[model samples]
Every structure is written in structure tokens, then in C-alpha cells.
Target: MGHSLKKSGLRQTRYGSGSFSSTYKFALLISLSRLAIEKGQDSCEGLALEYTDIAEKFIELYWKQAVPYTFNDEGQLILNQNNDKQAEIVNQIIKLRKIYSSLELLRRDSEEWLTLLKEVECTVKKMPVRYLQNINGQNFEFLYPLDQCGKQLILLPQVMYCLRQFSEIIEELCQKRWIDYIRKNSTNAPILNQLPNLEQFMFEPSRNQLNAVASVLVELQECKCFYCNKKMRKGSYAVDHFIPWSLYPSDTGHNFVLADSSCNSKKSNLLASDEFLQKWQERNEEQDLVIVDRISVLGFLTDKERSHKVAEWAYTHAKENNYQVWQG
Candidate 1:
């Protein structure tokens, strides 16, 4: 299912819209732009993959820190320290603007570095605002739903009020990251606000983001392949996008499938259905095998061919997996 909005949801409110100081905004944009350029590579089309990289790094380096920690009954640190470390790194990053400027200038001439940075910038500029738009109308607090890979708009008025209060700190960090980067880089470099392609707060997740999603799935399934019923250690499997990213780039969490890499790649973008069932049956005598296909970005899914194919695949998969089929 697609993302939904709650009419009475007060969670969609923006915090302090006018609160970000010029310094913070500029610093934040710069940091994002720089990180994008440094960590991502350019695609065949010349656009940098930095947007993907930044998204990956953002989640990797900072996602945990952004989360709040609670203590246990024994007064031990019950929460993940990884998240705490991320927060610390972020704080350090806030301080790096002043300290790193001098060091950054000395290394500006490295062609390899410059090339990488440029690529990152190219990618970040193309990310869509759809992710960020989910926060509109509420306290301006939105989370990239870790489990769902989408966003959840808050609805409780109290939560909304608290989010507005919390945004002051988060927004400060966001702004600081931008300003610091600008100060460190040359004026000739791209200005973040001026980038026509810049998305608001939403970022197109990178492969790493998918990995994180995969990790969550593994945890959900106790580190086993959803299809093969095998133990999946690190590097033994991949999280499949039931709807391939190329075909349905906009989808986040729900469209994901945890499966063996070979099985996933075989089904890429091909509608799961009866024909697939026939082929799967032919390949394996097991009647319990369920087959899934990758979906397309174009055309109405309800169209005869697409719908039939999907239905066939889903039914077959259900039967094979011994799972109940809940029709949407």
C-alpha cells in the first residue's frame, strides 16, 4: 500500500519554520553537498551517485544518534551504543566546521578528491522532495520509518507539541552541517539553496539504505532467507526489491522482499504469475514453491496481463510458503 495521511493527524505539523539561523542553514547545506560529493560516485549519465551515498552515510553514521536512548531497570545502558556514538560523531561534526577549514584548504587541489566530490553533488541534486513532503501540515517532524522504509506523520497533538520542541535541536544540527560546509568551500562552488534540484529534507536512499532495510528484515525473520528457509549469515543473501528500484524507485519499505540473491535477480521486474508458476514447477517438482516477480513502473497494475500475472505468482508463492494469503 502507498503512504497515507491521517486527517486528524497533528504529526504533520512543521516545527519552527523560521527558526533556522542563516549560519546553520548554510552550514548544513554545505555539509550535505560536500558529503554527497566526497562519498558518492558519478553514474554513467554523469550525475553523481552522491545522493545515494549521502543517504547511505546519513543513515549509517547518524541514524542511531538521532534515536533516543533509555535506561534499563538496573541503570545499565539498555539502548544501542552505536546510536549514541552516532550522536557524538554528529556533535563532533558540528565542531569540525571551525577546526577543519584550515586542513580542508590544504587538500583542495587533490583531483581524485575533487572528482569524487563533484560526483556526489551531481547525485544529491536529483533527489526528489516526495520523502520530505510527508511532513507538511504537522509539527514538521517526520521519521524515515525504519521498518517500513517510508515516513510516519505524527497525529497526537501532544506528540506534535513535543516534536516542535525537539525540532529546535535537530534543525540546529541540520543547519549547522550546511553552514559549516559553505564556509570551508570556495564561493565558486555550488550553493545549496540555489540548487534547483535539491529536495527538502527527504533523500533518496542508497544501496546501503537497502542494506539497512535488509538487516531489519533479517532480524525480523531471525536471519533467515524468507524464500529458501535457510540461515542467512552476512554476505550469504540480499534483500530483494519486490518492485525493482529502477521500476519503482519511489517505493520504500513495503515493496522489499528478503530472499537469496540468485532468486531475486531471476525475478527482477518480471510479473509473478501462472506462467512463472509453470516454469517454477517445471524447474522444481516441489508444489510448495512460491514465485514472485519484479513489477514495472509503467502501466496500470490492474491491466489484464499485469494483474493476472501478479495474482498467479502471489497465489503460488502463498501455497508454497504455507502462509495465509491476505488479499489487499
Candidate 2:
């Protein structure tokens, strides 16, 4: 059943098959999968998601890419997201990025933020939401019914379950395809063909943002390594993903930990041991408010329960597959 669902879900992503003109389809699919994990449950029940919520996800997904991607310290250019013109959302976000240094700052200005969200919501509903399920000129309503939903997108029963179950695979596929779309776009291919680490630039949180987060973590963790409990000198510690980004790419506030360089390097891309997991959970519970207040300002999403849910999903997948766990 899992294999079947994976196949079906993957097929939906390739609906138009190499004819994508814009990245909206990829963005919408990713938003749905992440929302399934963050908002839906493990059950086979249908989930109703507001178009506004999905619009916010689209903004988050495109926000980083809207900035100029620097190459070789010589030049910077924003990758064109459409064949003929920059994506409307990307263009809008690029303008906003000029005014606001980070996503959180834009979010804080409720007036401007609401205006953007409303615009994005209209676009999402009118564009990808209308076309994502169309396969080879036929409407394939595997995800949701197009006619029934008005203000909210309702995930068909078991669609939510499959999205949650296969989120990692789905996310990776979406990202790879999104990257391919950028690389193949006639305007981008000339310059982006040789760029390395394009995936990191497209998805990962910026180093500057992470550095700002590290400052808050340094104070919160009392200057000790999160894993070893060792006191670390200033300027030597790194902000480590308590849940590695390779496992789950999204950055949530409580999933960060201050680790010394050694531990951070040694534990790269591996889930921490169960003991550390417990400690991390305890730390989050204790510092939930502090993390939300501090880190959200730095442009990271911060919800302790949501972070814990993602952790639960990650750890379960790890244990089932006997994934290597870092012991510190």
C-alpha cells in the first residue's frame, strides 16, 4: 500500500510531464505535504486546509529563492522561475525582501503581510490549485476535488495519510524537480548550469540567519554543548539541527541546539541517541516560549508541539530503519 501510494503521489507530480512553465505546481505540492505533516494526523481522514495557510507555505517556500543567488563572489542574480517572466510571487517577494531583511520582519508588519498573503492566496487558488491534478489534459482528482473546495483545500481521505507517510520522499522529489525546472529554464540554464550546491541555496536557511539563531541558543544553552554538556569558548560553537536537515529539511525553532564544533561535525546528518532526544524534548518544553519569542524574530517557524511532532515522525522512521544514531 505504501509503495502504491508513493507511485500515485509521484505520478501526480509529473502530471504535465516536462511541460512545466512555472514552479507553482512544485510549490503547491510541497506545501500540501508539509501541511499534512504539520496540521494533519496519522489517520486516513480527510483534512481541510485553508487557502490562506497554503498561501503562507508558498511564501515560505519561495521567500529564500526570491533573493539574488550569489555565485563565485563576483556576481549575483535571481534565478528566473518562469519561462518568459519571473514568477509573480517571486517578483513580489523580491520587492518585499528589499524592504524587509527577513521573512519574520515582513510577517510582523501585519498590513503589508496580509496584502501579500491575500495576493498569494488568490494566485495559488487560481493557478496551481486549479491545475496541479491535471494529468495529460485530463483532471486526475487524486488529491482533492477541484469543484467542491471554496476557501479551503480538502485533502481526500487517505491522501493526508500518504502525504504524511511519504513526506520526506515527496519533499526530496519536489525539491529535485524544482531545481531541475530552474536549471532547464532557458533563461537560467546559461548561467546556472555550472553552479554547485544549488539545492542548498534554494532550500536551506541562510548562514546569516543561522548565526543570529546561534546567538540566542548560546545564551539559552548556557554556553555548554547540547550533547556533551561541555563548556565551549565563544566563537567556537555551532548551531546544530537537533533533527538533522537531511532527514527533515524544514527549520523549526525548537529543533536547534548549540553544539561545539567537534560534536556538530561528528554528529552530522545522524539522529541523536534516544537519551539526547529526551534531553532535547525536555529542553524544548522548558524553553518553548523563549525559543518562539527569540528565534521566530530571526525568520524561523517556532511551535514546540509541531517541532515535537516532526521529531516523533523522524525518530520513528529512524528506529524502523535502524538508522545510525549519534551517541555524543
lDDT of all the models against the reference? 0.34, 0.87
State the local distance difference test value for candidate 1: 0.34
lDDT of 2 at 292: 84
Model 1, position 302: C-alpha lDDT score: 14
What is the TM-score of each predicted model, taking all chains together?
Answer: 0.26, 0.93
Q: Write the per-residue lDDT of candidate 2 for residues 145-232, one digit (tens) a residue.
A: 9987787999988898888877888889889888888887899888888988589899998889989999999899899999999999
Sliding window of 10 residues with minimal summed lDDT for model 2 = 8-17
lDDT, candidate 1, at 173: 44
Residue 15, candidate 2: alpha-carbon lDDT: 55
Query: Residue by residue across 1-328, what tens digits does model 1's lDDT show?
Result: 0022222112221232232222222222223333322322222111222234443333223222222222232322211212113223334333433433321231243663344444433333322222232333333223222233232212222322222223223334444443333223333123332433212222234455567566656765577665555786687778765534432223323345576776666665543444433443342232111121111111001122332233343354346556432121
